[model samples]
Target: MQTLSRWENTPTFFPQFRAALLEHVGSSATVVVIGASDGRLVLPLAAAGHRVIAIERDPVALQGGLVQLPDGTEAHAAGLVERLQQEQLDDRVDIVESDFLDADLPLAARYDAVWTSCSWHYSANHHRPLADFVTRMQDLVRIDGLFGAEFMMPVTARHYLSEHYTSPERLGPYFTDGWNIQLTLRTGQFTELPHIGQPHPHVHRMGALLATRTSSVTTERA
Candidate 1:
């Protein structure tokens, strides 16, 4: 896997990924990130002036990363809160230490965008049906708001958890009815380093989606 700096240097993913979303959700918008591990996906958005609420289930996992500082020294960046503090970005970020499925988020379309990278596909582990999980994510965003996600698929379908692996073809079916699909990119035959300490690397199939909510759903006004 590329280092954080390398990811940012590319025009393909990472830095560009956030920039692409920024076209729809402005830099100052309020964004909700599900499975926001450490500060990788949400930190740059916060730095760019967005109000970010980062949700993660395992607080311990969030604490295990190295953070490079502006002063030329690197530190053992602890949890999300600590990362925000170390970078002096706590004011724009709200750290939510809870299972996203268990948390009671706002009902009235509170966020401008809802995003997840390689996280939403794990809904199956929690026994939340994929369709239902997609619906719940849609419900989190207001009309015209955006919903974005990147899912990692196993090379052999049966090798991993059933709900964890999703095909590029399977994604659109879940959101087409309720969303104005903005972008769908599916690519494969690449090796991905395991994020959760799998000793050996594995071949991967990756798919990403960016969609805008077009359907109406009732929610109490905040």
Candidate 2:
């Protein structure tokens, strides 16, 4: 793995996601990663022959900045673009430097797979409904393409009040008809160590879903 100083020590699925992608899609599929922060998922996919459309909004995660690590030491971090260039994987990825939902993406530019990891639970995303976020991401996947997301399930009291923090079963209705659900996984509430963005211990429950879009279903869009 090409290490990004800021993102170092962040526990992320590296080759596992790649392995899953290979099992579902053929080699060299085009994948759109919804929260491609600091090249964590993007670089690995790119290295494994997948062309990536990485959408990110955070300048610190996208560009670069000084930050404290998970281990409590401050270090200047390499931006996603810079890291891509360094790893020579820049050509394999198209970076959308804007909020995922607000980014100007043509509907025709669908991908083989659309993915997000722990996105949308942030207060920044509270402005939009959870359905809006899922619809937008799912819309980007071509027929028979994969839709994958690892999301934070409700933990705190306020989390239960909001629809954004959800579980795999709770998110099932969004897939509608003709979508084959391939996977649904969840992790029990667990404590996460302090990291750059999160400077203190935090408890969280996470859930993931991987489904395939077999055919289109007409629905009202927000």
User: Which candidate has the highest lDDT of all?
Assistant: 2
lDDT of model 1 at position 167: 58
**What is the C-alpha local distance difference test score of each model?**
0.67, 0.82
Candidate 1 per-residue C-alpha lDDT over 91-126 given as tens digits, one digit per residue, 9 for 90 to 100: 998878777777778776468888877765554444
Candidate 2 lowest-lDDT run of ten:
9-18
TM-scores of all candidate predictions against the true structure = 0.79, 0.91
Q: What is the C-alpha lDDT profile of model 2 across 1-222, one tens digit per residue?
A: 656545565544344455567887868899999988898888888888989999999898888888876677888888898899899999999999999888998888778998888888988899988988998988888887888888889988899998889988888887767588888888788888777778888998888888888887743443
RMSD in Å for all candidates: 6.2, 2.1
36: Cα error in model 1, Å: 0.8
What does candidate 2 score on TM? 0.91
Prediction-by-prediction clash tally: 0, 0
Estimate candidate 1's RMSD in Å. 6.2
- Residue 152 shift from truth in candidate 2, angstroms: 0.5
